[model samples]
Target: MITLNHYLFVSGALFALGLAGVVVRRNIIIIFMCLEMMLSAANLALVGFSRFRVTDGLPDYAAQSLVFFTITVAAAEVAVGLAVIVALYRTRQSVEVDTITRMRG
Candidate 1:
């Protein structure tokens, strides 16, 4: 039988992987994906906790509602991040982090 600890461990592992990707990758697109991964990991943990915390044999709706809100936020973030990335790519012709590091005035 799966337990809350198991869910939490998986969530932690996914978050770590996402964090590593964000730190090590130079491309903005990859970094964006990693950020989404981190969000997903958080959502999973929330759902797991909500599922385990039974109230009269029913999972808590509050956590699930929060998860929905989080999903909405993540979706919005992706749309905005992609737009920014596209603009950067058009101006620089590259999506690498180094291209954006040095500012031109």
Candidate 2:
């Protein structure tokens, strides 16, 4: 049968993948995506723990609330990050990290 440990392991794997992406990628947009992926991994573990803990007939609204807040903030982050990328692209003519470093207002 599935267990909380199983979910935790899966989440850990996903988080590790995201971390690798963030560390290895030079592109800013890809790093942002990796950050989002890491957040999703945390959410999975939170929900899994909440579900297991609430088996005693208690409410698990906390986990749901946390996930909701995470998603809201992630959406905001993506919107702002994309805007920055767009602005950088316009100023530099390319979205690459090397070109972006030379960007000026």
Candidate 3:
């Protein structure tokens, strides 16, 4: 039977993978994707915890509300982040981290 620990372990693994990708990858798009993955991992953990914490035979709404807000914010962040990445790519013609760093005046 699946349990809270199972959900947590999967979430931790996913977050770790995302972290490693962000740390090692050079391209902006890949890093951005990793960031999103990390966010999703966090959301999974939150939902898992809320789902497991039974109260009066009902899942907690408070934590779920927080998760809802987190998703909303993450969506906004993706929209803005993608726009910025697109603009940067157009200006520099490259998505590499080093390419962005050389933009210093």
Candidate 4:
């Protein structure tokens, strides 16, 4: 049977992979995707803990509500982030992080 530990392990693995991607990849878009992956990992862990923890018969929705808020914020982040990426690409013609350092002007 799947348990909280299993969910936590999966979340941890996903977070680690996302971290690695963000650190190793040169493309801004991939880094943004990895950031989203990390967020998803956190959300999974939150939901798992909320589902497994005993609440003395009360309906525990705090974590779930937080997850919803997180999702909303992530959505907005993606919209704005992608727009910025597109603009950067239009100006630089490349998505590599190193190429953006000259944008000091």
Q: Highest TM-score among the candidates is held by which one? A: 1
Which sections of candidate 1 miss by over 4 Å?
103-105
Stretches of candidate 4 above 4 Å error?
56-59
Q: Residue 38 in candidate 1 has what lDDT?
A: 97
lDDT of each: 0.93, 0.88, 0.92, 0.93
Q: Candidate 3: misplaced stretches above 4 Å?
A: 102-105
Ten-residue stretch with the least lDDT total in model 2: 95-104
Query: How big is the RMSD of model 4?
Result: 1.4
Model 2: how far residue 87 lies from native, Å: 0.3
Model 2 C-alpha lDDT per residue in residues 1-104, reported as the tens digit of each score: 98889999999999999999999898888988999999999999988887887746975878979999999999998999999989887777776676555434
* TM-scores of all predicted structures: 0.94, 0.88, 0.92, 0.91
Predicted candidate 4 versus true structure: per-residue lDDT over 15-48, tens digit per residue: 9999999999999999999999999999999999
The better-scoring model by lDDT among 1 and 3 is 1
lDDT by residue (1-105, candidate 3, tens digit) is 999999999999999999999999999999999999999999999999899889999998888899899999999999999999898988888889977776542
- Model 3's lDDT to the true fold? 0.92
Error of 2 at 68 (Å): 0.5
**Model 2 spans with C-alpha error above 4 angstroms:** 55-59, 102-104
